[model samples]
Target: MKLRLWPDALFGRLALILVIGMFGGQLLTSTIWFETHDHRTLEIPSRIFASRLADTLRLMQDAPDDAARRELAAQLGDDHYTLRWIDGPGVAKAPSVAQRTVENLLGDVLARRLHRQAPLHLMDAELIDDSGRHRGIFSLFDSRMPSGDFHVQVQTPGGAWLDVTGQEGQAGRQSEPRALVIEYLLRIYAIRFVAALLFALVAVRIAVQPLRRLAVAAEALGKNVYRPSLELSGPREVRVAAQSFNAMQQQLIRSIEERTRLLASISHDLRSPLTRLRLRTEMLSDAASRERLSADLDEMDAMVHTTLDFVQGVEITEPRHQIDIDSMLGGLCDDLAETGAKVALEGHAGAPVSGYPRNLKRCLQNLLDNAIRHGGSASVRVQDERESVSIIISDEGPGIEGKDMLERVFEPYFRAQPGKTHGSGLGLTIAKSIAMAHGGTLVLRNRPARGLDAVLSLPRG
Candidate 1:
């Protein structure tokens, strides 16, 4: 089987809209909150501390000679910052183990707090001591810090400015906003998913209310035509549809009632004239003429009666009942045989089916009468399949001709063999109508050996 995928329906679409809107609003609000809170909370404290450390570096750089520079580097070892002095050649020399240990400790603390490792970029101011030729080597990545990296600014010896800033690791650069962003997004999605499901359930329930009403009203209409017309009310568009449907139903009922009344009136007016004609024929003088006129009158009466029966038959709305197929067919065959008509029953049966017993009986009787009238006899069979029951009636008469097999069978007034006036040509029509009323179908097919097969298949209720 091929599967087809279509766009979301009203309920699903509504759910998506609700989830997206809610998630977007929540995400935007979270972003704004984080920006304001993070800047005021952590960044301010780190910047203040950096400024103080820079001030200490400036005092050390103001010392007069290499001796003072070395002493300063030793004194400030781990108290607040590390100090280093530069020679005239600006060469940087290593710091003591104490300074290195303090830096490592600070880096560890930052890593624990921020979930990332970053080096503190506190610069050491450089200056030559009183020995004249370059003092000792002072080490720092840069004295004039640029904004591209995380750095701080501080005053040095001789009123010069030095920039001290942090050195960022790859993980530090990526982790800050990336972790927060993923947190916010996952939260938004969780809320959105839950909201969407709730929205879908509510939307579907509301949307199907009108359909439920329509189904109930339709079922009631089928049971009783005199029931009140359905009222129209719902959403604007749905209301309009409901009104239109109610109007159409009323119109259809009116039209059917009118047609049925006309048929009844015509049958009444027609029978009176037919009765009068029969009386008039009784007064004819010649015996042969009177008999001929009586025969003609009888045919005319039969035609009128058959036509009226067909019209009224069309209006039958019988309630279905459980019927024993085996017994019904068996009884029918027995009746026909008692009447001296050659008929036989065949095939497996004994299936109970739901249908209009009276109407079904009339249909079968018509088919059997047609068979006995045209053919020498008729044979009846019944079989029950998984989905439905099938009844086959076969007649050994000269089977229907080509094209006539399909055409002549169902027409309202058309007859076979031109002028052989026998039936009102309504038997097959009535049978077909009865079958349709029971949600079944009747079909005509030529028997391969010789004859015609009438198959009636009724769906299982």
Candidate 2:
């Protein structure tokens, strides 16, 4: 069940690969951006806030008196910034890990701009809800401000602590600012990500569309080799494959036409000489010589006729039709039974097949003849398979001795049993051709129990 759920088609697997690759690429890009850009989110805002504190201290130091400094500090307090003065050292305890990091960053910025570093403490801002309750440990941010906020306190050389409070800019208070960074990342790149996903889907579909067309064209070729050429599209490799397949199909058609033309020409040319030779043999005075010559001429004529018939029948351009294979096999069995041959038909097919009925029959007749000639008796069974139909013809006589001759027997004029008296060794060859012409196969095997088995498997159209 697990294996079955896995993709079996090219489109499915390719789509899977494309999806994984594209998503993985997006995630990898996001990770790199996160690692490289994280510090900028906190560093710029913190330094600017720290610089503001340094500027405020300088403003206070330049003031005419402590009372005027207090007034200036009060004036600095507004919506976005709050400033206050504290007596002696403030936050007289150990600072937090986050506080240390912010202090170092702010200390460096202050030293560069002010020409000296001041004692500074940075810590979390008091968490506020919409209801204005102090939720110290909890944050309002889930997907937005997960890192939260902070407040800073810098002590001046005058022994007074200057309180500076503000956010870390739009980036937020938390040093990491994970949620805000993620949201920012999404806001910036979401459309591009979606567009990339769509582009990949369409591109993959376009790529696979050509292969599907090629597959359809191939199946059509099997049905009729003379089918129209495939239209070229898709990637370079796919287009090349389509072009090659179409060219091969054209070559096959030309080859078949040339072979048929050659056979016809040979048949027409051979008939005239054979006719003249028949006349010459009839004129011979010696009865025994005349009979022998006549016999030789008859054999030659029969061989030529059989070869022509085999070619013509196998290559017949008949339109395919649905036919009951069982009835056809039954009829052949009846005809052979009339001649006292021990032939029997068993089993049946679920569906009729589309084929050249006459050619299909001729192919069956050849197998039956081979079985009777070599095995003395034949048992035929028609089996229905998922994708094709099998017509198995087994014989009871001696099976072929040469294991290597199984496929060779289907080659023209190549005899399986060379000493056999009844054939021109073209029966299996013709059978194989007829089967192939209908997009089928004819394979001969030595039966395990005894004798030989000739199995003809034809695709169901």
Candidate 3:
């Protein structure tokens, strides 16, 4: 599998971007500081040590003899440096890079004090050998201990050699290596880094809260037309988007209400005319023509009534609740059995789904009616999935006999097999509308073995 640096969710993507940006910026600033300021600060310790070395040289030159010089050196010695009198010019071993740099700095300072300079070399001199014997020594070499001595042979004008030695014993914490400085910086600020990351997480969450709430409200709106509109909050952009969405929702609700009211008025007004037409048909003397006219009038009246019912169903305003779909299907089958219909139920829903009880029941009722009407017997099956629930209702009669007629079956007033079934052709249409209103889908397919199957799939939450 390929590695994915980016996530699919908005929250994860935004958080990842924020963390990378913050961490990168911190790293860049620290690198710049270490280069420009941190390394340059190492010169301070070198300058202080150079000044003390020059003082030791000048004081030892005024000593009267070897014993007096040794006494004076002892008096001037400190924890960092131990002054002593020795008889050597310099050490035989070559100086390392670090040792050479220290030697150059001290030689330059001493030459400035003496007012003349050719080349000055400092060497090791064992004067005060009271080296710190740290117990539990772990190093392999005993000669390579922490003990160090600086021996300087200054040629006196009287042709005698003045061996001045200084032993630097104690280690100063200030003169640390570059890597050690970086390590200290990291250890000291590790907690601060964690705290800053936590702060970024919280800030990102607060910034993205509006989008999260908007998504939840949009999903709710898809499931329920009567869901309350979202309140405006958060950033300006998010607030504007929420306002636009709410406006669109209000316009849709208004349009649907207007259409429903108009259709209801038309249905009500035409009822009296349809009744008068039925009464007028009775006055006809021809018996065969009267029966035909009355039948047509009755069919028209039923169509109008079914149309009104469909319109009312579209305006459903039921609240969502946990519904046990299996129990509902069993109850519906029982009711149909009482009505002497061969309607049976199979399978079960393992859990309850959140939905509008009345609207969902009505949708199921229409599907079951279709199954029983088109086919002789109806079998309803409820399937529970991980993310969704399904209801498969099938019948034993012949399936849709005509091609291109399956989708047309859901069109209002467009019956595919006219005169074969007593229906207004609005049953499937209303059922599908209700299913969509509850964030579900209804599909119709012909079963090759027997008849038609209606599948209703609803989301799990």
Residue 218 Cα positional deviation in candidate 2, in Å, after optimal superposition: 4.0
lDDT of 3 by residue, 1-461 (tens): 98888988877777778777877777776655443332233233344545666665566567776666567667877765654444545554675444465567666776787565524555532212234443211111222223334555554322344555444432443333444555646753565577667877788789989999999888767756678888999999999999998997898789888888888898899989988888889999999999999988888878778878998876667677999988888888999999999987778888898888887888998888888887877998888898889999999877886657877877888887788888788889988888888788888888978888899999877
User: Candidate 3: where is the Cα deviation over 4 Å?
Assistant: 1-9, 32-37, 52-198, 231-251, 274-303, 324-327, 348-352, 384-389, 400-419, 445-448, 458-460
**Which 10-residue window in model 1 sums to the lowest lDDT?**
139-148
lDDT against the true structure, per candidate, is 0.63, 0.75, 0.71
Where does model 2 exceed 4 Å of error? Answer: 1-62, 65-203, 219-224, 228-255, 282-296
Positional deviation of residue 267's Cα in model 2 after best superposition, in angstroms? 1.1
Q: How well does model 2 score by local distance difference test?
A: 0.75
TM-score for every candidate vs. truth? 0.57, 0.62, 0.62
Candidate 3: lDDT of 351? 88
Residues 317-367, model 1: lDDT tens digits: 566678988888888999999999999998865468887788788889989
